[model samples]
Target: MFRDEKGFRPTQQIFTEVPPKYDILNRILTLNLDEGWRRKASATILEENPSRVLDLCCGTADLTMHLARSAKQSAELYGLDFSHTMLARAKEKVALFGEDRVKLIQGDAGNMPFEDEFFDAVGISFGFRNLTFENPDARLHISEVFRVLKPGGRFVVLETSQPNNRLIRAGYHFYQKYITAPIGGLLSGNRPAYDYLAHSAINYYSIPEISEVLLEAGFSKVSGQPYLLGATAIVTAIK
Candidate 1:
């Protein structure tokens, strides 16, 4: 496992320990902007009209539910996460979106349990950063994403990115470091975990950097769309 400057590892324990308030905390931390990110990612995947889709690290199945409801293609959606508690919550909400169409699995991002070329499209929102922070080589997991994608499959990613505007970038860093981390620790009682995540966002790769990484992972035609003043980005690529 790779350790950041603070020696924090983005493991399942960090996530599972705060499952009960994870959704609400996310809403507060991002000022409800996280939903828009998921919406855009799901809309992009739905545009492909894929028959089968996987929501990698689909915490609480928010994106999975959105895809099932928005996709006119009647795509079969699957959500995978390493946290058992998170998956449990996802299972409880599966029926509202038609359980037959949406399935949830507890699994690793690096070693996904699905077969190669099994999905027509794969979408992961707000989860890729954790994998990148934890793994020594992010390609080990990105390669897994490539393996699961069918020929010409699309990969949709929504994660933190460096802000382009100097003023907005400074503000974003301030909020993540001083405000978001403390608030998350107060709410979830896991200061170190949230602190590491907050730091990760401020230090994560730029949109172009992530695009290049995907290209090196054997993806062709990579594109990144920035959102929320460049603080977040939606990256799309074809296998």
Candidate 2:
């Protein structure tokens, strides 16, 4: 059964304070690579032209807007997040697309408000790590995604991953810890949030590791494509 209230209070607290500068900070932290990653993931998400799509944990609606822009005219897009502040920012951005086409909802990931097998495809960009890394209800969140997706639906994720190369992994961690954390914290005035983000990204699951997690969650098939020296990856899991 789903929890009555939102879980992950600490993560929620971090997010509550970052929405104002969240988008710009992300661009700065990722050197603008986050946009391209989302673009690629959005393209992959729409390849099947699913009639209904969801951008789960869709902070700031970056991926949601991408999906709306590329999806077929008849396709419906939904973005769900726990932060009202994040959803407010997302609402402003997605307004360019008609409201009827793209809907934004404030809600928890571990306990979403939707019928079973409701969506044809679900996508998360940079937010999956927030849901799963060190989260007590990680499996519940994944199960919620699985439950909401159609039998043959896809769960596409674009997120930070550990590099396979030992040297690159070390460098990546260094960049995340030293460069990303400081700069993002300084710019966003949320050092603790950035610190936590850097810590999580530095130690987040590798592509293979996360793929295994998806497989264990009952996905029939899982595949991944790494990018930028394997510092980030896009994983697609079929239900």
Candidate 3:
């Protein structure tokens, strides 16, 4: 089953409803640091000189475009997303970026269409948290990622993390609970959607736990590093 099947219909609704305001809300909600995070994530993937890359759950192709610009023009970049609304916007942005080599695929991340060992590198940003929400086993998506990556290929994840400092963690939680949701609602006109985003970000899995999941999925090596004082991170695992 697709990881999204485990997600309630509400999850799909939120994704669909938020697309028009997604980029703007994200910029305001993250204080524009999301762009920097994408750069950092794309840089990590590009370091491998991958010719074929997949940006799984690549909403609006934000990070995918970043990788496309940094990669060789001959490289092929594919972005997969479940939400049609989101993918539509991603297509517009990809074209605007002049990334003709990038292809957008609308499908489930848990059941990728690519062949075994098809991609040299794969990455996902904030979207990874959604996959974990109802996917307690994690194997569905994890195995899919492991299966599509070439042996020695890397899967890089950029997602939220628990802040290591108690005070900062408290502040972060406060912001999630009291600030982000309201601001998101104002921008997207979807209160529940924003509320879900807040809850997911604050309660998502830890960096160490994610590394273990990758290892269990058959990755050969795993490493993770926190950024922005542990509020976010880049975790990489090699297949």
Candidate 4:
């Protein structure tokens, strides 16, 4: 059964509860590789030269801010997340770039509150995995992404994954378990949260499986690029 199956408040609630320390713990847990991953994912949007972009799970607006600054053709950026605390920080960050170029809203990924074909591109960073387990509703999220994007829109996702190389995988597991979790717990006082992070990475589907999901979700062409020695991956699909 999924973690939320047993009367747990939604993941949004969990994020709200932990919002105070979420960014700090995230930086510590990834040793700041998290930012680099977002950078790589945002590059895909740049390639598409999208004028309007949607960033799902735009926690703290890190990627949203990056896109606003970097994408030469990106004139408007919309960030959506369920947690108000996360959105609050994101709003503050977006302000640094001027409110006219960026907007932040509180919304669910599986059920985005946006119109069909409203955006030129969509990007998700470390957010899809939190939508649901084995994500039965994943297609809903993808469908919404597809629906909100104009024809020929690009959808890009950056997520954690198991490395194929045995040696690197083993080392990655060790770091996640011993080094990442302990530090995360110390910083956030939420050992279980960090444990959940590690477990999700271990139990989530392989890149190929995720690519299949994207295709089933109605994306025309799906491709994945592995990064950080395959500890993380970015999947790009066209609507």
The residue pairs in collision within model 3 are none
The order by descending lDDT is: 2, 1, 3, 4
Regions of model 2 farther than 4 Å from truth: 1-10
* Strongest candidate by TM-score: 2
| Candidate with the greatest lDDT versus the true structure | 2
Q: List the residue pairs that clash in candidate 4.
A: none
* C-alpha lDDT of all candidate models, in order: 0.85, 0.88, 0.84, 0.79
TM-score of each: 0.93, 0.94, 0.93, 0.91
Superposition TM-score, candidate 1 onto the true structure: 0.93
Shift of residue 230 alpha carbon in model 3, Å: 0.2
Select the stronger candidate by lDDT from 2 and 3.
Answer: 2
The reply for model 3, stretches above 4 Å from the true place, is 1-9, 97-99
Q: Write the per-residue lDDT of candidate 2 for residues 99-156, one digit (tens) a residue.
A: 7889899998988999999999999998899888887889999999999999999999
RMSD of 1: 2.1
Whole-model lDDT for model 4 versus the true structure?
0.79
Per-residue accuracy of model 4 over 1-239 as CA lDDT, tens digit each: 33544555344454777546777777777878888888888888768688888898888888897798797644777899888888878888878777777878898887888888999989988887776445667667778888898989998888877789999998988888788767766676656666666667767766797788888878878889998788889989898
Q: At residue 210, what lDDT does model 3 achieve?
A: 77
